[model samples]
Target: MVPKRKNSLGGGGAIPASAIVLGGGEGRRMGGNKLFLAVDGLLLLHCVLDRICPWFREVLLAVGPKDASSLSLLLEGRSWASPVRVVVDRAPGKGPLAGLVAGLREMDSPWAFLMGCDMPWIQEPLVRRMWALREREEGVLCWEREGYLEPLHAFYSRSCLPFAEEALARKDHKLKSFYPQVPVQVVPEEAFADLPGHRRSFEGINTPLQLERFRESR
Candidate 1:
């Protein structure tokens, strides 16, 4: 059974939202499956799921064709706070945009939060703040740091489906390529200035060196 969604703002009510974790990357830089890499006694993917699953009614993991078996093993015998669904990219090698499209297509909620599987440092407080700011917004809601939008760590509405589809059809796989065609709310960095670890909330482990440094720091 899927767990009940709660308002991230502590309102004691159900919130209509889903969490989408993009895990279809080739991980060439990490030399292999980076999602399975162990960090703080938990796999990088699991660590991310554990932190964000409770905030949504359902959680969808977008994986590549070759990731099914490994991901199944990682999730076996484990229980989650929400129903977890695994979605494979419709078109392989199309990048994060493909994963996002696959995830949004399966989402039943009006809004979904998109997160990269490698972002193990994502903070719930910062996410809650973002969700709070997304109230009834009709398009994408993301944070901007140093003038660049954090598309992977953002909220996307089902209304973005058309734009996403258009981008894919045009062979433009950039995750933020459709932003200009939709209503986007870019949350300034100062909004999260008071949150703990706000500066590193969107940090992701990409290469082996970065992973090693992350593990050492932790």
Candidate 2:
């Protein structure tokens, strides 16, 4: 049987979800830059955008101004093919919470699928599954094996904007800290496995070694 879908966004045809590829991380563990890392012959950022572009109405990338020019050069004329927009973070080096706030505030759609740019292994099918299951809950986030939320790769509603903004204002950057204040659903590993591809896609790429692993796997 098909799993129940919540919110049912994007209308009957396209999912109302707009994607926010959070590419503002410092990538310190990867020795400086990571979004530029090559994975399976594709830039990690492009691999992420390519995966989610088909599932959402618009794709907005939240990147840093320092790397904005290079990122723009990567997309150039390709903007004609998709509704891709590159937005820079106002408060840099703050963390993923800041990026999420920027994404939600800049969103023109009802829901936003937020993911880190370093995750080249994340499959589109898993993203679609999370979107389909998004409920009245503020977020449909990942339940990592270590029993923590994978805040980056998740589905957050537009309604969570206010709370998220407040969290940032209070310097409460931890995504888990706001969970008690709003509704949230954890997409367990079993449920995530229903979608095709490796179940460990939520595993983030932090070092060059991890990037090499992704290359080897491909």
- Name the top lDDT candidate: 1
lDDT of each: 0.82, 0.72
Across 1-218, the per-residue lDDT of candidate 2 in tens digits comes to 23465533323444677778888877788876676877666777776676667667887878777877888888876643248888887777778777777888888887887878777777656666666665564544444545667777777888787888888788888866577777787756566554556466677788777888878876
Per-residue C-alpha lDDT of model 1 across residues 148-207, encoded as one tens digit per residue: 999988999999988998999999999999999999987787777777788788898988
**lDDT score for residue 27 of model 2:** 74
Q: For candidate 1, what is the lDDT?
A: 0.82
Winning candidate number (TM-score): 1
TM per candidate = 0.88, 0.83
Q: Residue pairs in steric clash, candidate 2?
A: 10-15, 10-16
List where candidate 1 sits over 4 angstroms from the true fold: 1-15, 216-218
Stretches of candidate 2 off by over 4 Å are 1-14, 39-41, 79-81, 137-146, 196-198
- Residue 202 error for model 2, in Å? 0.5
